[model samples]
Target: MHVLILGGTTEGRLLAGLLDGTVRVTSSLAGRVAAPRLPAGEVRIGGFGGPEGLAAWVRRHDVDAVIDATHPFAERISFNAARAAATAHVPLLVLRRPGWVPVAGDRWHEVGSLEEAAAALDGLGDRVFLTSGRLGLAAFADRPEWFLVRSVDAPDAPMPARSELLLDRGPFTLDGERGLLARHRIDVLVTKDSGGAATAPKLTAAREAAVPVVVVRRPPVPQGVPVASTPEEAAAWARALAG
Candidate 1:
């Protein structure tokens, strides 16, 4: 049995680790990051042209199933995978981690998109901690709020005029997050609901500091497709197929 994983996420990597050696697994990455953490399987980096191209590749490679385990905010690729899987007549599963829900003492402003997130930041506070990744910074570029843009890579132009870039990767500690918020004097945080435990300490810090957060809600996965919320669940699906 052969499986193609459209993966650039921790969950994807975990799934690959689970299925490697048991079945043939191939993981594809978009290669937007300078250096991405590799999964434990045959890995291909770059776009497969588009949906048509992806379908062609699936047919050519004789892929039995496809699991899209990309970032939750990766809206375009998810849709493309849906189309490709349907065209190729292979089973498709989307592995999206669950979104974070606000708890007691959490001030959450949930919006549908980055543009809306920028709007939600209006009057929320300045000194914004923008962690929605580098690509979406353009939406907040013209906003008057000063931004602390933290991303794995330094963002390109069209970022906020009064923003300072902080390049860092996640699995951030709560203490570290607390210190960062204090050092930057961040009053409001703008982030996507790209949910995971490693990337969630900042939310806790924000909550502890009584800071407001503007969360850009994740786009819905393409409809009529099976969805798994964990790598374990996705691995089970793959193993079932293999059996």
Candidate 2:
């Protein structure tokens, strides 16, 4: 049986590794990220054209199952995967890591999108620490406000007025982030609910400094799909389908 994994996150890579050699597996990456960690399996980079393209690929590749393991905030790709799997009459499973929970000391103000977060910035702070990735920087471009944007790669589009780009990867230490917050005089932080330990230290730093954070809530999961939180559970589901 051949299984296709819609992958771009750590959970996706781990799932691919867990299923290595167990079944004929292929992993698809969006190719937007630079220097992505390769999973253990056949790997294909770039878009599958959209729903129709993905559907054709599923049929042509004789795929037996699919796992939607993209980032939680990757709503469009998840929708396309759901549509393609249904069109091909193939079983699909979604692997999503649980979101982070707020602790007492954390001052989190949840928003729906980048624009909303920008709108909420008025009362918060002038110096903003932005960790919302590189794609959606345009929403904040009109703000003309001061910001310290950090990303793995340099942002493609022009940034907001008076903004400084910091090229860095996360799994950053609390002390490091604290120094950044302090040195930049950042009083507010903005981030997506892309939950995981790797980029979570900033939240802790914000908490320490009593800085308010504007967290973009995660996009809703596609409805009526089998879901698993870990590679072991996903493997079990795949094995059941194989049987």
Candidate 3:
């Protein structure tokens, strides 16, 4: 069976690795990052021109099934993948990691968008640790705040007035995150609910430092798609369908 893995997350990479020897797997990356860690399979980077393009590619490649293991907050592409899979008349599965839930001792201000996050920063802090990724920095541009924006890639124009860019990858440790927060004197953290342990240490650090976190809620996944939370489960589902 041939599988198209729409991958840009840890789970996607893991699924590709798991199915590499078992099936003919082709992994597609969005190419948002300049230096993305590649999975162990045939990899294609960049967009497929939305749903129609993806559907065309699927038909051309004779893909039997598709697994969408994109970032939890990557709502647009997820929806496109669903529509594309439907258009191609193939089975589709979504492998989305669960969102983080605020617990006791956490100071979380949940917002629906980056604009709300920017607005929420008014009385929170002057120094901000912006972890909402590179795309949405424009929303925070007008806020009179000093931001330490961290992302794998540098963001574009219309950024915050007083901000320093920290180009780094994650899987950060609590010690490292704590130090960063302390050294920068970060009073507030702006982040998305892009869950998984890989980047959860920041939340711990924020809790420990008594820092208020402005979390942008994740957008809803596309409806009526089979969902898996782990690589193992996704592989099992694919195998069943392949059989």
User: What's the count of clashing pairs in each model shown?
Assistant: 0, 0, 0
The alpha-carbon deviation from the true structure for residue 4 of candidate 1, after best TM-score superposition, in angstroms, is: 0.4
Candidate 2 per-residue C-alpha lDDT over 7-96 given as tens digits, one digit per residue, 9 for 90 to 100: 988888988898888888899999988898899999999998999999999999999999999998999999999999999999999998
Model 2 off-target regions past 4 Å? none
lDDT of 1 by residue, 23-122 (tens): 9999999999999999998999999988999999999999999999999988889999999999999999999999999999999999998899888877
Off by over 4 Å in 1: none
Which clashing pairs does model 2 show?
none
- Steric clash pairs (candidate 3): none
Alpha-carbon TM-score of each model against the true structure: 0.98, 0.96, 0.98
Candidate 3 residue-wise lDDT at 150: 93
Model 3 agreement with the true structure over 1-243: per-residue lDDT tens digits: 999999988999999999998999999999988988899889999999999999999999999999999898888899999999999999999998889999999999999999999999989999999999999788988898899999988889888999999998978998999999999999999999999998899999999889999999998878899889899999999999878
lDDT preference between candidates 2 and 3, better one: 3
